[model samples]
Target: MKPIFPAIRLRDKGNWLAGRDGIVMAFFIHRDHSEVGPAIWRSIQAYLRAIPPGSLNWYTSADGDMVPLDDEGWEHNRHVVIERIGGGSRTVELRESPSEAGSYQVEYYGRRLDSPFHDAPATTLSFTFPTEYLVEHGAVRLRSLALELARELPLNFGYASFALVSTQGSWASADWDITEALLARYAGLDAPRAMRLSSDLGTRALAPAWLTFLGQPLLGQLGGIDALRDALPFPEVSLLPMDGDRVLVTLDEWPDPIDTRTKPIPPQYRALAQRMEPFLFQYEGEALLPYQQDMNRWIRRFL
Candidate 1:
């Protein structure tokens, strides 16, 4: 099928300017209950090499070396540090997986910035495709090539909440949990205290209302006040698949657009809708850079 969006243009030759919310194949370190230490790391590296423009390069290492660690050296080791090639500062730290009977840990060391424009730190973002491209020329390869083409386009600024991430399960599971937790715990709280909930306890008590308005049901909707709250329109957030992809590339959380003509929408409700606009975009199999950049700008404004 023909691509809906034109190939992205890159002003910065060295770095790829990915549109916000676009999915890209990424290297992830996983720990499974199987033989060999750093085996998963090695597998992912090998996988990275097989892809076109498969330079097997590191963003951090000056030498641009690309090699996987073997079991003999890493299996028993407590930690494995994977740094980006080509002198990039990003890195990931992998530790043994933990269990009730055992213990293991992994950390995402995102980009270590010398300085950033905002108070927010540098971040590492990841997405995944299938293993078919490395093995056979197919749709996955097409997507990768399209991404590379997009990379060749101009550079633009974007912001993310974190630099490094270490999760206990699949990439999707970890990413969803972390993003939600960060949004609720950090950005949401840091937002200006509106006049509606000025009192200390009022703020605490009313906080859940905002969350509920956002489509996160704190208390189960059985009946009574909770059920009434549930009936209210709150913005909803969900991860949904794009086309036939195994993973859901898009994460949507928006205020419910349903007008409350019977009951006028509150001022804060209006603020939330205005606040969240930058983050929402319609994707119909097109280059996502513009939409992603827009969303990032909104996130930055709210942050």
Candidate 2:
């Protein structure tokens, strides 16, 4: 069956990795997880669930021991490599190690199983893989479909921000940043647009609104909104006034008529909303601080 959406299977040997490890196995489609549309999410979910259990292997280091793993456990511990193609015919490999600087390598793959891209093999892809594995695997590559899947999922094991970022050091704000970047790249807007959409502020009102908005009744007294807003990607505050606070934003103007906003609410969104609705009462009318519970709720909502 010509799969609905493309997906890549990630496996590890020697070090355990997977969803639980803050590594995403692959980016599949779901209503709430992506703006990519339901059809795409269904295709991706099918591709992943249909992965014939045990088709992939996982490795992990436990107590100075490298052990093989089963599907469930492996999926929880392995780090997934999100593939991306950047410049024409080029693939960029990203792996990071806190012990050292990240290894950024770009190369071309013509005809090989490890080679994932198929567009004349001349396109550039940017992707994230665990340095712990890459150091052992020694320079891995992916295909075009794999890259696209990675970009779509845009998160590694629910840990690292998958798009335009190399590490998960900022896992706290990964989701928001990823969403903003995706919107900016596809919709043509920067941080300002993200803020406006989430905060309901206008261009001229952005400044004063920002001051008061940041001090929202809920988020102000706790001094949490500033941190949250700072975590987002926005145009420089200094540049906002000169530009009339005209932040860049993208609207789909493609002539191809691909309706990204196709209707029919998704189950994932419903499920997520349900999951988050309960949390609103957890704090009992207090400002929604950025606690793990708050983060979890937002993550549920965003995904």
Candidate 3:
């Protein structure tokens, strides 16, 4: 009857906040905002429909602030999101409540291929949900929802897994020590940097998660599904093909936040990482965190 992943809470500015052990479903698209705006909106709508009503009741504003999701705020947010997605703005972010115990959050970073500021940009959309929802609705429902969103968006790469979810701004400054501690103990928990990845991920694959979505050029480079299957011979891993030449690689029946203090990294995950190392994205330049020596080493943890 224990929880699948550890529940984490941390204090920031004298306020206790939920910091880790949540589910994150994210996708990266290589298309420009003008080309993929409508589809992203559709996928967002689908996510809203799948979750409970009022699960999201607040959103971040233009000034990088949180606004109540009132009647007027809702209408205005819709307009802003549409405008940003249509290339009216460079990035789009929406959140429920970062200070709340467990909040639902969504974020999108668009790409302007012609802009000097954007270097190898690939638009990214990330959706976060508390583990309580998964416990209530079951893993099948969560996987079905991920599949549904995948079909709606033309994603080059995507994943769903156990993650350390927090407000990026505060968590980085206040909770990183705690984060490093938790990560040391739990090898399966992913600490995602969606905004940074949006700018740098490009067409490369990331480390494999519980549910890894692979599409296009990268999938072709790997010699398609048959080759991938031959490389990853684990029986627990399931490869489900989807429309649009994409494949959803499910590592196991459920996401495991393996406590490495007591057990080693799961073999299935290591196998997938080994098969994907060549095509995986390498983090260059400065370390993402002050304490971390090399981001690439972190990306290759499964190896």
Candidate 4:
């Protein structure tokens, strides 16, 4: 069988980075932790080790303690070169460190295993081992390794808001093709169309909506919705506009009619709202305020 990994597609990007080619991902750890623990490093090392032996290689600084800056002037927190490819291809770089506020940060450049013979493929490593592993019968990467480590570590891992990124060294970038057909299969919801509203506003609104629903990974949230979708007669996910305290759940148009504060959520939207309550509450808490603010700005800019 082909290597079964979960490949993430692009959701949105800023004007500058959208044009570039790359993969972006982020992990948000609990605020209380001052530094990453041993387990995270061990997990990282193990994940790196799982790659095909000769295909995977990394670098260590000469001083061996402090990191060495590369051509781009980025300093790897661990002072370790995760991997160094030999060819003239674009150099891949990874920078990781904790912020003054305390959350861990990471940015990778030109880091992805490209197809031995494909470019601009819709999917890359969807959390799976390389394709060679399936037929070669040797050591291979596994999704379970990452998933297990994730369960043990205290961090949130998922798609990063990619910009004009160097995800694929030369040309292979994984971007979401958000056609209604793809949306129906991936999100179990009808894709929003440029109907009923002025083209510009509708175009803006729909992009952010799709990112929230399909770009970010919602392992736990999806688990709950999967059960709900199986048990109840509701779509897996939906988007609404929050007007003051009022949230409009169904949108057949742009600039939906604003309701007065006295209005209650209609019966049809109640189930979808209830199903989405946990994720809403979890994301709306105080801890993520700054992140939420930045995300809101991105949406507004993209929309």
Candidate 5:
């Protein structure tokens, strides 16, 4: 079957990390204890070569020399640093899998940035298909050509919260939408204050605004170290402070969306869709782009 990525143009949100302006890196990882070896490198080169000449490009040298798919330039190392030129200014590399652990990691940028912009590095592409195309297709497609490189491998995808993500000086100055449930629970504190409680604390209703984690067996290391598990809060029915202002409410995916009145994020079985103020990005499907460009726009649009 044909793949959906290259055939479909996915709008990238890019990363919203503020202040430190640097290149957004794209990482492709796999499990099953596969190591980056000569065979794999050759496979990658061949794969790239098969595509239309200028559609994608990878480099093995700083001068931007292409890794030859032919017998001429086939050399492998425990870890290989390949700079991907066409798809944004991202550095792609693969390391030897550890002895006992099958660990895979992916970092995605948010919305698609039109390349060759005024940015210093002139990020060309949005790291659209950074990793080997097959690896990016992942387990969903049974006949993914790139899968031949690393068979029997599973992946976990997510990206970091951009450094520019510090929002709201305090609950007083902060404007969070308050949910009816939260109004009932944190009755004493007003809506603004309740918003702080949900996010700062590990409330089940709370989800991270910076990074998103997807793929089977969501790992804490991906989205965040302290993200709430798939389990719902003790009481199935609890009011969450979605907006810290006027008792507005939204709930994350959990026991059921029945009473919440909001649909859960499909398939993933988790929803962090509530627009947290100061949130500049939406970490969806493992891509960490700027889901929302303007803070105020994001709040008004989602809320």
Candidate 6:
């Protein structure tokens, strides 16, 4: 069978990379780094174990240069992750070579609880996996991994969905045209802003994705899982109760990169968006560029 989304690589002009299908899973933890750091580490370990050995061959160093994930470099990166998790603000990034498409990637941003810079503080952990892994191992395996990670972390809001992953931020990259075009064509392809959302998301939820994880006060605010189920009555939607008073809402059997150019947004996604509208986070600033305007519009696609 043909893949839903074929792998894409534009190494010369844009240095872009995307797999046949891409999965972007992110969690926002309202707790301070000191409290959630260990959990974050464990989640990272879980991710590493899930992927092939040596899949991650590079990591971003303190100087922002990509360094080989050699023994010494790996140990140093580990120290940085643990040390930053223990005390101050932290940003940990590990990934395969940017030259390769369908590479495994992990990005984490941990903020200090008492930092004056962040009005809405939350630690954000994001993971990117090529859907080839899912196709080979099965969707159930990925779902189980997501559940395990969610169970371990104290997250306020989290989501897993099909996305267009690139080496750089999609909004600010030179290949914004390609990114924008793909996003316009595919309603299910998410443009994740983990770094931006970490500082602003706080306890609020973003738009719903393929798999939406609701925890704590957010779930309570929505009147719990029962209310959600009642609101989203589509047969394609499933609400699974999780540990820590969290719930994982699955939108469909597999993520659909619905071609919006030819079809309407999936009803299940639209319904969940409407149900979560009151609590969804909207982009606040004025969009100065066409790409920015497109992003803001995408944020409100379901509304």
Q: Which candidate is the best by TM-score?
A: 3
Better candidate by lDDT, 1 or 3:
3
In order of appearance, the predictions have TM-scores of 0.26, 0.21, 0.90, 0.31, 0.26, 0.89
Model 5, span 1-303: residue lDDT tens = 221221101111232211111111111222211222233344445444534344422223334443533232223221332322233333232211111100121111111133342121111101112223334343233122323322222223222111111111121121223222322222111111121221221111223312222333233222332243233232221222111111111122111111122332232222333322233222234434452222223223323
lDDT against the true structure, each candidate: 0.26, 0.24, 0.77, 0.27, 0.24, 0.77
Give the alpha carbon lDDT tens digit for every residue of 100-203 in model 3.
54457777776766546666778888888888888888788899999988886778899998887765523454466686787778877887778877877888
Model 5 regions more than 4 Å off: 1-60, 71-90, 93-139, 142-270, 275-303
In model 6, which residue pairs have backbone atoms overlapping below 3 Å? none
Task: Give the alpha carbon lDDT tens digit for every residue of 1-303 in model 1.
Answer: 211111211111223221111122221111111222233344334434544342222121223232333453343222333422332233333322221100112222233233242122223222222222222454445333433322311111111111112221222222344433433333221111111111111101121111221111111111223333333344332222122111111111221111233234344434433433333222223565763443344334322
What TM-score does model 2 achieve against the real structure? 0.21
Tens digit of lDDT per residue, candidate 4, span 115-136?
A: 2322211111111222233234
Q: Which of the predicted structures, 5 or 6, would earn the higher TM-score when compared with the native?
A: 6
* Alpha-carbon RMSD to native, per candidate: 17.8, 20.8, 2.6, 17.1, 17.7, 2.7
Q: Candidate 2 — number of clashing residue pairs?
A: 42
1 against 2, candidate with superior TM-score: 1
Question: Distance from true position, residue 111, model 2, in Å?
Answer: 46
Q: Which of the two candidates, 3 or 4, achieves a greater TM-score against the reference? A: 3
Candidate 4, residue 73: how far the Cα is off, in Å:
12
Ranking 2 against 3 by TM-score, winner:
3
lDDT of 2 by residue, 244-295 (tens): 1112111111101111244332233233233223222122235555663443
Where's the lowest-lDDT run of ten residues in candidate 2? 248-257
